[model samples]
Target: MAADGPGKKKHGVLFDVDGTLIDSSYFHAMAWWQAFRREGLDIEMSAIHRRVGMGGDKLIQSLVPDCTEDMQEELKAGHSAVFSTFWPSLRTFDSVRDLLAACSDAGLAVGLASSAQERDLEVSRHLLDAASSIDAWTSSNDAKESKPAPDILEACLEKLGLGPEDVVFVGDAVWDVKAGAAIGVPVIALTCGGISEAELRDAGAAEVYDNPRHLLEHLESSMIGKLMTGSLDA
Candidate 1:
């Protein structure tokens, strides 16, 4: 909530919430499915799952592009309404708070670079309970486009007041890799979001992990860890 004033950290770490730090990917997909179902649209759950990390509008556009503009808005709102019902079911991944603390202690600005709604983000932050470790965060208000557009990542950069070279993004989706790549920020991909390691690498991820706990366990060897410690090689 406070600005990174004088003598603040130089390097930063941007993290995605859903499926990366939290275990809500499948729930999100189910919410989208229910929303589409209400419109008499029978979208496959697997299809919705593939677009879970991105915002609702982008997800609806990607999966149901044939719908009218008004229909798109309706579906998006429906998805939000449905997703809200499952907020109480949200849980943080193991060692999520530790990972944020590790970066913060290493003198890196910790940021949440998610396109989630503000209220949802607040819920996630409360779930993590690592406000002391966080330096900057983003909500849907900060970016219009979702993953693969680089807008969300760009907003995080602005929040941290750092350039792409000073940050390493951590996420669980290939769209995250693509967005980071678009802005020259290296990505550390996690496979717990239903994405394969090979697919993440193919999408330009510089490193990969199974989950937040795995990355935290191997912090010294991960790109984010190295970046935080000022040991990353040019």
Candidate 2:
């Protein structure tokens, strides 16, 4: 990460990896579904998908509140093992690289604030292949708390030496909107992660778009664009 010159306030965008930049939400839901099945829990895929942005512990607890600690650990391991098999098929969303590049080219710092495990994050990052435009990134290991708690976002902000007021977060889940709200950051929501635009708006998203391509096309009028043009306070 590069330091801003004296008195310069750094501005940037923090992106959620899964579902936002990468098309792995359903894969994750499936993995969790299989993990639950392994435990004889029989969790529905829809229930798992809605909690995809959360860390494994939280996701397991949310879907199976009575799950024992040992069972939670087992489920996490199970999910990880199952999810790893999908690595070969994981892919970045349309124009994900181009969107990141546009943010970088507009003189903004770019950071990935992901709640994924370190190894999983690495795989997704590899799929993104736009690392040159990224200034910093965070994994599940980087935060003490997860999405809907804002710890990962805070960790990313710290890594970039920026404050919530200086950055906008982009994500595809209601949990992401909630996380951004916790720290007073505006969240730009995308529906590509299987979330509905109405639900994203209902969660208090500053704006909603279809995907990276949709957002990139309307960048000049979006919150990110306002940040780049100095119309939105950093």
Q: Indicate which candidate wins on lDDT.
A: 2
lDDT of each: 0.87, 0.90
- lDDT tens per residue, model 1, 1-76: 3345214678888999989999989988988899999999999999889888776777888887787999998888
Query: Candidate 1: where is the Cα deviation over 4 Å?
Result: 1-7
lDDT, residue 175, candidate 2: 95
lDDT of 2: 0.90
In angstroms, how far off is 124's CA in candidate 2?
1.0
Residue pairs clashing, model 1: none
lDDT score, candidate 1, position 181: 90
TM-score of 1: 0.95
Q: Which ten-residue region of model 2 has the weakest summed lDDT?
A: 1-10
**Model 2: residues >4 Å from true position, as ranges?**
1-9
What alpha-carbon RMSD in Å does predicted model 1 have with respect to the real structure? Answer: 1.5
